[model samples]
Every structure is written in structure tokens, then in C-alpha cells.
Target chain A: MTYYNIDFSLLDKTIKNFRIKPQKILLQFPDGLLGSPLQSVVNFLIERDIEPVLSADPSYGACDLPLNQAKMMGIDHIFHFGHSTFAFPPPSEFKGKISYFPVKVNIEFSWNKILEEIIILGWKTVGLLTTIQHVDKYKFENETINNSNITFVQHKEGQILGCNQDRATKIASSVDGFLVIAGGDFHASPIVVATNRPTLRYDPFNETFKLFDEQFRNKYLSKRYALIEKAKKATNWGVILSAKSGQFPKDKGSRILNMLKRKGLTAIPFIMHNVNLPHLSNFETIDAWIITLCPRLATDDYIRIKKPILTSRELAVVLGDLSWDQFITPKTGEHLLTIEEFE
Target chain B: MTYYNIDFSLLDKTIKNFRIKPQKILLQFPDGLLGSPLQSVVNFLIERDIEPVLSADPSYGACDLPLNQAKMMGIDHIFHFGHSTFAFPPPSEFKGKISYFPVKVNIEFSWNKILEEIIILGWKTVGLLTTIQHVDKYKFENETINNSNITFVQHKEGQILGCNQDRATKIASSVDGFLVIAGGDFHASPIVVATNRPTLRYDPFNETFKLFDEQFRNKYLSKRYALIEKAKKATNWGVILSAKSGQFPKDKGSRILNMLKRKGLTAIPFIMHNVNLPHLSNFETIDAWIITLCPRLATDDYIRIKKPILTSRELAVVLGDLSWDQFITPKTGEHLLTIEEFE
Candidate 1:
């Protein structure tokens, strides 16, 4: 029985195709997909004589896999829904254990408004981008538009993550503008800032298209610059390093800590699984914070935190290691450090 | 250098006395002690040529150690402050790595008011109990009172956890009533319920003494009984198994899942590092929840959760495997499963 338009038959087929039998499997879902028929999935597994356990933690993306917890509980196989495989190598121990199932949303999309808006902009060639949920829709619409071109980054066609905008950047030189079919400006704004080109975002949920222009990019950079200025006055800093599967980079954290110490600033490294506002506020003596985990914690959650929180790249700007222009400018190819820098 | 009355010299001496010089150590503090001098501690470690890392996750007690995270970061030493060592044994992998610092509060207490109240109550013999922060005060007051007696449970003198009340229960036959010198009723209420005796809690922060009587016990149990009745009608259950250092019990969780299945109820085991309202609300299909982690989650956080949540013992009552009287009665000595069952 399918609920919330999630196709369970695909999951069943995928499990049946596996070579070894999975007696116990861990199920992970993003917050948006939690309303799906969970009991039905539990019953289905029970009928097959397989035990299913749900991960009751906030799963941000494919990078936030609870592999350690799964390993501790002896759950070798994991089925992560709502996102595809992240563009990063898994830890050595959890290489083949994780299976990503991009829960594709089979919903109707009205492309008339976005297409007209794109045509009105007088763009000859346009790059198409979307998230995993709307990749099938993106593919179907890719064939109908003659000016549209879609590129594959890693696994899916025309899919881009919040941190990785390679699909839009790879075809930036060829396309005049870009059209992103996704939920909101969260995915589209990065493309606009990275490519420095006109980008139109079609929110399938709200059925509206909005353009991210040069004005939006300037505002985003100005906010980041203000935070960097605030961080310069901080004498003590808390460097937040994530404990998620792919987010934890101990070496990078150590380098940042060493840099801050050289500048005569008291820096403390914090290892956390969830970096929420409450957890950050616990360090009362920390004048500022430098989050080495998700870049969105600096960009999106800045207002929620009282102290000035900056990303690693932004911290580089504060320490005179990098210029503001170089920090915002888009780079070519899938760089190894860009995954952590952007995220 | 001293902030919030935390003695740093003790920590310094303890580190210097260790035979193995630690190059890197993880520092963990509970939320109540986060406001203490953190940068001073960081500076102290830096002066010794050692790197210090702070754990930003919510630390509930000594049981909430981040051993796995520390191991992953290659930090072999951990100094857990604000609470003493937990009674449970550490995981085999992290046997000798953890060190506990009680962070004793050096605040003055006016025990005259509490002593007068106890005298008016006409209790000839009294058993003393307090937490790590107030254990020194408990010992000092024990020497002055003619009828006061203190008992040791595992580590500290006159220490009682929210889940474990053995300090009071061990000397229950010798004392007419119990006097707990702590901040709040969190550590005192369990003693009142477990022993079913007259208990007085002295809030050192406010310097007030309040007695927990039969009326208070009845009110607490009535609320729990209401939730258990509400949970009996639930067809779908979310069994939460914690991933904290000492809270994770996979065997007990499996037994609960099996019992639920035998009773024809759909039960899904949830493995969580932090069990909060937002995380529990993500499972929309679950009609009720059974948390096998901390007992306080069911008692303290029930009002915040919309659905009924029962502890393992309460779940036992719902399943008719345990009577309500047996669930509340105090057991003798240190039982193997009592730690898990109470927590």
C-alpha cells in the first residue's frame, strides 16, 4: 500500500535482487518523507521474516548517515530514502552496507509558467537542474524543451545537491541561463551565485517560478561579509566539527584549530552529531563559532544563533588567508575540498 | 580563573598525576555546568602541550559519554565533568580512557532551616543523599547531625541518580526518613517513589526544604497510569532505543519488539542518540511510543509529547507481565537489569 506517492514496489524489488538475505535492515528517511506509510513498511518486512528498525534522528541529507550506530547494532544493510548517494566515499567499514533509494515524487508539474518566463528572458540555451525528488520530471521535460541541456554529476541525471552545484556549473559556459525545477530557492540560489547567471526556480509544491538575479547574489555575500567582520573581534572561538558519516573531518578541524591558536585566539574543537541552536548556546564563553560541517549552518542559520558563526571559507577570509572575491567565485570541476568547503 | 565555583586546580593536579602523558583529551560537560570556565580549561591543556576537544552534544549525565566519537577522532582520554563516574561498566573498547571529575560546587549552605524542619517532623533517624555537586555538603552536614547516616553506592558518598536511589534504599531500614540535599526534586522524587517513605529535598540553589509526601506520590503515579491506559489502545508503537554510552540496550529492545509482535501490535524499534519531541514527532504513523532509554523521558517529557509514551516498566504493566506494585517497589542490592529498567 503506497502513501504520500512513495512507490514501495521498487524497494521490494531492490531487496529481492540482493544476493544475500537481509535479516535486519535499518530504514532512514528525511523529515519531509516521514508522513509516508511507515507501518505498512514495517508489516511488509515482518511478513518476510526480516526485522526493520527506524532511525529516529534528524536526517538532513545522504551525508548524514548513521553508519556508526548501525554498525554498533549489527545492522549491516541500510536503506536511506528521499536522497540519492552523496558524491563522497563512504568509510572503509561501511562501503557496501548503505543503499540509497531516491524516493521520486510522481506529481504533476505545470511547466507553462516557467517555460514562458524562460522564453521571455530571451535565452537561447538553458541548463536544467533539479533535486532527486523531481529528476524524472526533469528528464521528461528535458526532451520537450529544445534549448534545455541536462548533465549528470555522479549518479542521477540533472541532480544537484544543496552543497554541490556541479550539474549547473559544468554547462555554465554553454548555457545563457538556467531553469531549476525543485522545491524552493534553496537549490536555485546557489546556482545563481555560483554561475553568476540568470536562474529561474520552479517550485513544484507552490507551482510558481521565481528568478534569482544579481541583486540576490549581492545580498547573500553582504550578509556573509558582515558575519566575518563580527568574527574578527572574537577572542575565543568554538570550532564545530560534525560527527556524521561524511561530515566529520578531524584533520580539517585540527588545521583550523591550529590556525586560530597561532593568532593568539583560544579555540576549542567541538564534535557534535546535531549542531542545533540549543547545543551551540551551551558554550557560553565562546565569543564566536566556526562551523566546519555544513555550510548552511553559517548561511541559513546565522540569525538563529546569537554569536557570529562562519564557515571554513569565511573563516579563511577572516584570517586573511583568502579574499572575499575568491570566496564567492565559482570554481570548475569536482574538487576534493569543495565538498566540505561548500557543505 | 575560577568561574561558577568549579575548581580547576583539582583537574590540573589530576592530569599531572597520570602516568601516561595525554597529547589529546576530550572534555565533556553537562548543560548545567556549561557556564563554567571552559576557556580556562582549554588554556590549561594548551599550556601542557595537549589539545582539548569539547563535546557539544547534550550531556544528560555520566551515562551520556561520547566514547564512540572520541574513539573515531583518535582521542583516547576523556574528562567528564559535573558528575561522577556512572555505576555501569564502560564498553570494552573504551575501558581505561574515561576519567570523571565531579566539579564539586563550593557554595555555602544554610542547613539550619532544613534541620529545624526535620526536627519538627519528629524523625529520629535520617539517611542523607545528594548529587555530585552537593555531596561534600552532604558529608559536612552528616557529621554535625546526631542521627544522620550516609551510605556509599558504587562511587560517591550519599550520591543518588535520578534513576538510582540505592543510597537511600540501602539504609532504608536504619533511617526513619531520607533527606536529599540537591538542587531540585529530580534526584529526590525517585527515592520517594521507590522506598514509599517520607522524603525531604533541600534545594541548595534556593536554600529551601520541601517534603515529598503521599499526596505527591499519588499525583505522580496517577499521571503515569493515565498514560499507560492511553497507550493500551495504541495499535502502532515506536520503541525508542538510545545510542548513548550506557543507555543503548539492544537485547532489551529486541525483547520488547518480540513481545509486541506476539501481542499482534505493530512495533518499530527506533535507535536514537537524542530522544526529543521533534524527533519523536517525525514518526507520524506511530500511535504511541515506548522509550527504553532514560526513565525521565517518560516522566518529565510526557507533557511536551502529544502521544502517550511509556517506559519499559510501564509497558510491562500495559502488557500485563508486571503488576503496578512490583513496578514501583524497591529492590535490594545492585541488580544487573535495574540500571536499564530504571534509566
Candidate 2:
């Protein structure tokens, strides 16, 4: 990555010319010790400044730097941002002061939300994880794990969470399956299976925990379930699907109409307009309406569909749960499936 | 929040009197457009730059900004570093040229690694998600999601992923849950749940996906469930846990030892370094041993014990589909119990 930096190259060269003498130079460090942090030190010395030079580095947690190389480059003193990652040894010549930045962790993820969701997931056992950058914070999370049915297996030593495969494999053998959670590219699931253990990748990115199941979600839910529930309620189903000015469903209100007619329930599929269904439009007659949700007027208009309305995906979800061959037959066209005469 | 700016307040008096009557000027953006992109423009006019000005705004995605103020502020030309959220109407009088700089998306997470672990999760249904910062890459992932039983659902309107509660809730109801692969605080879990969906967050700090169940990981991924199938076979009957470090179990490590012990095996527990095996010198007599599993030393050191060693958490998975009460006697230690213990 070509970092757009405040170019200090010109200033460094000016000092390197040795034309000006320096006393106590105020050397600034824009970036930290990830790469080179000896610029200002070298600049100060070239200008005849004394050895007590000051600079800083960011050590968010633990930091690994080229200290010997920095010393060789004529560095003197240092101030650090973030927490201390290394123990600075005292030089043979105890010279200048070294400062430390307190390690303060921002509330990036709320545990309260996690705990609440855990209750919702009915998760009896939880997989706990974090980044290696925050090792101390990882330990702090242990207590929180104690309050929940959380299994706190930590992935340590590597820059990312799953670098150590053997470690996670051993962990997988212990839990029901592993809950793999982490920030950035450091989730712990890839490594958890190294031990031939089953794992659930708990993605903290969207605050949801789902077990790894290779089978499609078709079995867990269905569209007919909504229709079934609505039918049993003995109510009229009002399906308001989207057919905008330029875009229209290829089926053009055909598939859903056939299915409802076969099921012996009255259904309508069309665009939402003011003149269509006015006045005493009792929603009791409508059982379940499948709405082809569109981006153009979705949030603005679709929210008004009082009766249970299904989006295209939601309709698909219901179709998936039932045996596809039984309800809908595959057909060749812009549309893939046709409602089988509901038989 | 403490911006290390040049503290231009010191130069305000001098800058106020120095006015540049320019036909066009370039204004660079800092902190992206999450902040006001007009800061530089306002400052320039305040500094007395009294003619038509050209400014560059590196704003991106569907994020909209006030351009009328700019036009009123005497903007005759514009150069943007990144994509614009809205179509720019051509300047009425100046007929200035408007340009764009496409901000390329950077993949911090390795897709190969993400794919490998998902296969292990063995789930038939999965939800895909990303942060607003990475919405651009969602199209490329469409093919990847298609390869498996995955459903990619993003907040279609206004691609900003995190920090928007209404959108998150909308998304939560739309899909089962989401697999969020993200970088920085932008993809944190609580932020993900703002959508009211169950989310699995992948850390993007590293170039590859590292499972979070190892003791060596940097992030605290205690909510993840990962199993490790190692090269070595375990022969231990049971394991023990400890609080000598004053740290509670992170869910994954909470209960492997007891499960093995319940299946007619011996499970032992000890304080830190407090174990004194009777057959310390015996090679084959010792069965498998289990512990909290912070394997600081390598397998080379533990070869003398010569038995199948395991963790308390690992044994639980082997005894899957069993009663929790049969293994662990729920104690009243501050140890929390999450879905990990039950699920």
C-alpha cells in the first residue's frame, strides 16, 4: 500500500546536508514502529543535536519491531502509543526516558447484546474468541464467559485467530462444535477443524451465531408454513407484489395465482395502486400474499401490507421446505419454477 | 477524537489576510466523507479565497452530501478522489469539468480460508453479509456463495452495513442470520446486531482466516465452537479445570474433562502446576490426561507421559448427543454457562 503520508523526506534531507546545528530537536513520528521509526533521530544527529532524541511507536497490544536496527540507526529515546507489547531492557548506558500509553479498549462489541442473543439462540454451550492483538482483553472476557454457558477456548500466539490449526483441532474435540469468532481475517474455525473437530463459526460481524450445517436451510423453514398458518386463521390473504413502471415479474401474477386457486383460497398478485382495493377491504379474506419486494418503493410502500406478505426470497423459503417436486415443478424460462397444479 | 492537526489556529490571523483569487482550487479530504467534506472549502473562503473554486471530495458509496452549499460557495469546478453518491448536475455558469476517482476495494480476509472453514461448519443454510466499507465486493462473492448452500443477503438500500439499526433489523428478519467478514470496529458484533440479526463476524486484520479457538489467538473468540482433529490420538479418560489464574472458562474449555470421566474414565483437576502423577516416570501406565489446554510447551516435552491427553472441552464433543448433567455437575462458581454447554 502506497501510504499517502505527510512527506518528511524533504526535511530529513535538509538536516542530512549538515548545514544547521541542532540542540533539542522536536522530532515527530507520524507513523509508528511497524516499519522504520528512526527518521527523526537520524535527522537530529546530522544537525548536531545531542543524544536525547524522542520518538514514539503504536503498540496496540504486543509489538514486534527492529530494535537493534533502530539502535544502529542512531536512535536515543522513545514514547509509545497503545499498550506495551515488549519489556524494554535497560541499556548499558541508562540514558533517556521511555514512556508508555495506557491500554484502553473501546467497546467495539457489546457483551450485553451477545448475552441476550445467546438466550435467543438457546445456545447451551458458547465458543468464545478474540484477536491476538488484544491478549489482555482476551483474558478479561473469561469472566463474561463464566456468566453464560460459554466455552472460552482462546487462539493465541498467531497474528490472526486461526493461524494455529493444531491448537483449534484440539479445541474442536472438546466442544459440541467450535464457535469461531474473531475480528477481520482472524476467525478461529479454519484451525478448529485441524483436530477433526466440528465447529460453528460465530461471526461477530453481524452479531449472530449459527452452527455449520452443510445442508440447505430448506428443511428448517417454508413459505407454505405462513400460508398454512394464515389459511387456518380463516382470513383473506392480500398479496401486494411489486411491478414497477419499468420492471415486472416474468410470471406476471400467474404462479402464485395458480397455487392459491389450487389450494382453494382466493389470492391476488399485482402492483399496489390507490384505485385497486378501496374502502371496506377486509383483510380477513386474505390468507397469505407473496409480495415481490422491489427496491424502488419497498420500504416506503410495502410496509403497509397488513396481512402476512412474503417477499420473493420468503416465497422461495417456503417453497424450499416442501419437496420441490411436490409443489413446484422446474421449468425452462426467465422464471425457473411453476406452481404444480397444487394437487 | 484528539486530532493531531497542525493547530492552524496559530496561523489564522496571518491566513485571514492572505487571499488568493483563483479560478480553481483543489481541496483534499481527510477521514473520508464520514466527516464534513466541506471543511476545507469553508476554511478556504473564510481565509478569503474569493473566486470560483475547484475542490476534490474523496467521498464514496451511496453517502450523499450537500452540493448546493458548494455551488453557492462559488464552486466552479470539482475533482473527487472517490465515487459520488449522487449524479452531479453540470455547473450552470462555469461549465466546469467534474471528475471521479474510483476507490478500489481491498480484501483483508482470504476467501480461500473462509471457504474451507464453511465447508467444515457443515451447515446447509448460511447467511452472507459485509460492512458498508466492503459492499462493493459483494458481487464477486455472489459466485462463491452460489457454490454452497449459502444465501447472500445485504441491506440492499444504502449499503452502509453497521451503525444503522433500522436496516439491521430489516436484515435480521429477512434472513436466518449473517456471516459477516469485516475489518476494524466497522464490523463488530453489537454493530452487526443493530440490524437485529444473528451474526458471525470474521476478523480482517490478518490476510488469512485464523480459527479463534486456540490459546494463541489475539482476539477473544470464546463464542465460536471449533474442534481440532490432531495427528495424535488421545487416550485420556478425563480432564480438570482451574481458576488459579482468576480467569473463568471461555465456554469452549469449560467441560471436556468431566465428559471423558463420565464415560468410565478417570478425569483429574489441579491448580496451576499442582499435579503430581503417581507414575511420573512410567511411559505407558498413564492413560490420557486432560487440562485447561494452554499448551505452552510443545508435544516434544510431553512425550514422557505417553498417553492420550485431552482437554475437558474436547471430551464433551466426543460424548455429543448426551445429557449435560451426566458429565458436568453444575457448580456455583462464577463460571458462566452459555449455549456451549447445552447446544
Candidate 3:
């Protein structure tokens, strides 16, 4: 019942202070955390006399908000769990309706292990990146490491989002390598390919520093290069676009379509709620698909796609951008970067 | 490549007279028609120097339009195939942007077979209902059947849409039975149960006249009654609402929520783009789900849905309007009918 370690006091105080009597409220949780524990959360809300409706839609990241659903059902409030705030501004009307409750995982491992790994790897200064879960802990824990030889450079936000890693990319130049202070390969693996810097994960739960170095990068680079080569020969490209508020890269699809046209390739853009393979199979004419949606989907979801499915950055190679080779890793979070800006 | 039997000249003439210079257009076809033949249609548009973007999303019925996508990509026109005009009015902005091109399936069967079947069944008067494809032909052909005792009642619109059979329902009282001159069971099967009248189909391609009598209606009634029985015992119900233009039953979700509340049952509304099992599984507290979507899905898609899922009509039985027994058929095109109006 106490699994999420959510601040019940904070939630209660916020609801009391907002003064909006919610007849119905929606609770959204990421796919990983939508389990038995959520029932307890539902009971917690019910005990307070608030009717809670769980959003069954896929919550990939903070960017994929249930704002449209909230507005549709006239839900007074939405508690989005397991993620932090997105960089972009929410709709004006959604100001007080959304409340983010990020799950913070306390690092149970020794902090000295990261420093020992960095010294052994011969990296002088390493960029420290973690997910929202351990961002605060990593910031506080960084001060305890007094090794002058192995400096840890921290970004302004001090964390990385799965779909967006602009914070780490911004401070990539100031560090020799990147050390992700979190569990799992979800956030760490993508940063390695995106920044094209030496990246290693300091898993607190496992208490191990796993390297996602040259070997891992080369495997992904080869796969991306293969897709690029295939796309270069493709005459017709299906540009996939999403209409979901957060995932709608507003003008990105049009820009990609125009870019393809300039290369003398025939391309058409398709707008979808969620891109499913069964629906995409209807496009027999499209030899390849360029996903102008979440950058992670191109790698994470489409590894087995029969036809060559490339992300926006991967399409840059076909667009005659030779320097994009540095960021050849799939599912790399560079949604904002254009073909010309890939370094 | 000359498939689809589309009137190319008619299409050409319509485009010329519309006076809109469309550089890019969208082409949407039913899932069944999205095959090799569509390539010829694409070539037909491309030959006319009109760029065509094929919509790959699943087209359930005429109601599910890609308006959001059409607007997002700035598509000049949308050529929807295999369907005719919707019963409900389109949005004001879509007045000139959309066009319907229904696919006419030529009747290879003799017209006498229908009359022979009606005479054999001893029906004196029958209501005639054809799909958009055969509307014009049926209107002309109805004049040929001259029987003093057997009368053919024609509706004002002369056809019925798959998602709506209100036109036929309006004139059901004057006829002994309804004859749907459509190819498939999509339209005819639902009308049989909705009107609680004898319904028969004279399929054009198959050259057959089949009746969906009490036996067929009874089977559907049993299934729907079971769902209603299950929903009656459900303490927590998840009422799903959709925001997709056509799918969004504007205020129907809230109305249903309020109705459920009035019955002293605890229910919450969940607005979604489309209901999927993975998303619906997150709602552990909800024992049953009420789908306020295309009425067809509660019967067609949710057969395998683990938790008992009930349509609005089915939910009505649980809500105390016991007359839902009259409209026990699944996929009935009765969006406007409340439980009380069934009788």
C-alpha cells in the first residue's frame, strides 16, 4: 500500500488548496507501474471521497499526457504518475488540472562505486545523468564525492527524460563521458547513442556500472546505417505523424515531407492516434516509413518492422547529412534537432 | 489494375467543377478495399497531377473520418471510398473539403429471387433498405416489382448507413418485414434486432435471400442479456468516452455517468482515443465497462474482452429501462435511442 512512497500529505494539501470540488478525477500511470499497487492508490483516493478513474492508455513518457481525455470527460484533475514535468508548456486551460507525482527510487547502493568505475575507465570528467527518480539523490550524492581527478559535471535539470535528453546533450561538451545514476537500460542506453559519448550506467539496485560503450554503439550504428541505405533507394516514404497533443511534433511531419520532396523522393504524411503495424500494412506503395513521432519508437518499438522504419535523425543520412553518423544510435532523443544540426 | 469499378469520369468532372486547386489530397478506403486496386486509384489521381496521401488508419465506418489528420497535414480534399454521405451533418469547415465516392457492387442476381422468397414466406408488404452503393438502383428497380398484395415501402433517403438505420426504423410500422439490399450482414443483421421485426437480406453478389428471424435474434438476445445480468451486479463500472471527432458522443459519456450515479452504482468516465485491452486492463477496480462508442464494437470487438463490456443499449437494462430486451441485437445502429425508447 505504501509502495510508491507518494506524499499523501502533499496530494491532500494541494487538493484542499485548489478548492475545486472534484466529482470525478482521473489517475494515469506508466505501463510499468500499473499493477496491484495502483489498487491501493485507488483505495487511497476513494477513502478521501474522490472518485478516481484510471486512464488505460499507454503512458510512454511525461510528454504523453492525458489532457485530451481529461477535457473530454470533464475530469476536474489528473494525477500523472511515474514521470516528471515536460519541458514544453501545457495548454493554458490545463494549469491546475494536472498534478505530476514522480516516483523517486532511492539508491540503495554505495555512491563510491561510480567514482571507482570512472577512475578505472580513465575518464577525467564525466557528465552525470539520471532519470527523475534519482535526480535529487544524484545531486546531493555528488557533493560527497571529493575526488578532484574525476570530476562529475551536472546539467541544469540534473536528469534525463526517456523521450528527451536535451539536458545531457547540452553538457556533453564539458564532460569526457556520461554516468547515468539510475537503474535499467531505458534511459542510459539511448543517451549513449544520442550524445555519442562514452556512457555507463551506475545501477543502484544491482550495484553495478555497466558500460554501453563502443561495442553497443557499433551494433546500433550498423542497424541505423542499414536502414539509411535502404531508405536512400526508397522512392515512396510514409511519414508517420501523431495527433496526440504531447506527441504532435506540430510542423515536424510537414518539414520532413518537404525535406523528402527536395531529395526528389515521393512521400506522403499519415496522421494517426497511435501508429500500429496492422494499419500501416495498408500502405503497399510506401517502401519505407519515417517516424516523425517519439524518437524512441523508431528504435524501441520498430526494431522488427519488416520495411525500413527510420527516425527523423536517421533520415538525415538519406538527406545528405554526413555528420549524423555520430548520433547513429536508435531511439536517441533528438526530436528538436534538424538534419543540419546533428553533430 | 482497372479494379474498384470507380467512375473515373465522374471523379474528373467533380474535381473540375469544384474549382479548388488541390495540390495534395487524402484518399481513405475501407480496410477491405485498401489493396492492389487502390494503387490504380492512386495512379488515377497522380495522373491528374494531384498528390494523394493514402490514410492507413483503420476505417470502421463512414462516421470515423480522418478530419483531424486532414486538418493537421493541411490536406486540400479527402476522397472517402466505399461509403456514402453520413446521416449526421459534417462539421462546417469540412463542407467543401470532403467528398464521398461509394463503391457500387453490381447485382449479378435476378430481382425475381427476392419477390419469390417474399411470396414463399407469405409476406404481403415489406420495407426496402439498400446501402449507399445500391440506393439509386433500388429506387429505379422498386418500380419494376408490381404486386397488388406485396407493397415495397421506400424511405426518403432511399438507403441506410451502416452506423445508422433510423431512416428504416421510422417506416418500420408500415411494413411486415425489412429487406436490406446490401452485400454483407453489416447493415441487415443489426436492423433485424433494432426494429424487433423480421429482416431479410437479398445479397447482390451471392444471389441469395436469407432471413434473420427469431432464431438469429434469439441468439443475440441471449448474449446481450447475459452481459446485462453481469453489469447489474458490477459495483464499479468504467464508462469509456471517445474524443475522436465522429466517435465522440459529445455529452453521452457524462450523461451515462450521471445515469449510473442516479442508480446508486459507482462509475467513472474514461475518455480515450480508442479503447484497447491493454489500457482497459489498468482499471482493476472496474468490474465491467460501458462502451459509448460506435455501437458495433460492443458486439463485434469485445466478444473476447475479458471483463464484461456492455454497450449503451445493454447498459440500459442494468440502469432499469428494461425495454432494452427489444434491441438485444449486437452492432445495432441506434446511437440516438435511449433504453426507454426501445419499445
Q: Each candidate's chain A: what TM-score?
A: 0.87, 0.32, 0.85
Lowest lDDT sum, 10 consecutive residues, model 1 chain A, at A147-156
Candidate 2 chain B weakest ten by summed lDDT: B332-341
The TM-score values for the models, in the order shown, are 0.88, 0.22, 0.77
What TM-score does structure 1 among the candidates reach? 0.88
Highest TM-score: give the candidate number: 1
User: lDDT value for candidate 1?
Assistant: 0.75
Give lDDT tens digits, candidate 2, residues A128-185: 4444334444444455656766555544432232222433433443454444555433
lDDT for each of the candidates?
0.75, 0.37, 0.71
Better of 1 and 2 by TM-score: 1
- TM-score quality measure for candidate 3: 0.77
Which parts of model 2 are misplaced by more than 4 Å? A1-343, B1-22, B25-73, B77-80, B83-102, B106-109, B116-124, B131-133, B140-144, B155-158, B161-167, B203-205, B208-343
Candidate 2, residues B1-343: lDDT per residue as tens digits? Answer: 2121222342244334335334433332323431233343334444554322222122222222213223323444444433433342422333334433334345545565666666675534445555544556656445665675655555553243222233344445556545666654333443232333345556655543322222312121221122223312344332323211112232333354345545554332222111223322232223455444332111113443444443333344345643334333323211112212232
Question: A216-239 in candidate 3: lDDT tens per residue?
Answer: 877887877777788788997888
Pairs in clash, predicted candidate 1: A294-A343, A295-A343, B295-B343
Candidate 2 displacement at residue A13 in angstroms: 62
Q: For candidate 3, lDDT tens digit of each residue in B159-179?
A: 876656776777777778888
Clashes of each: 3, 128, 1
Error of 1 at A95 (Å): 6.3
What is the C-alpha DockQ of each candidate? 0.61, 0.01, 0.34
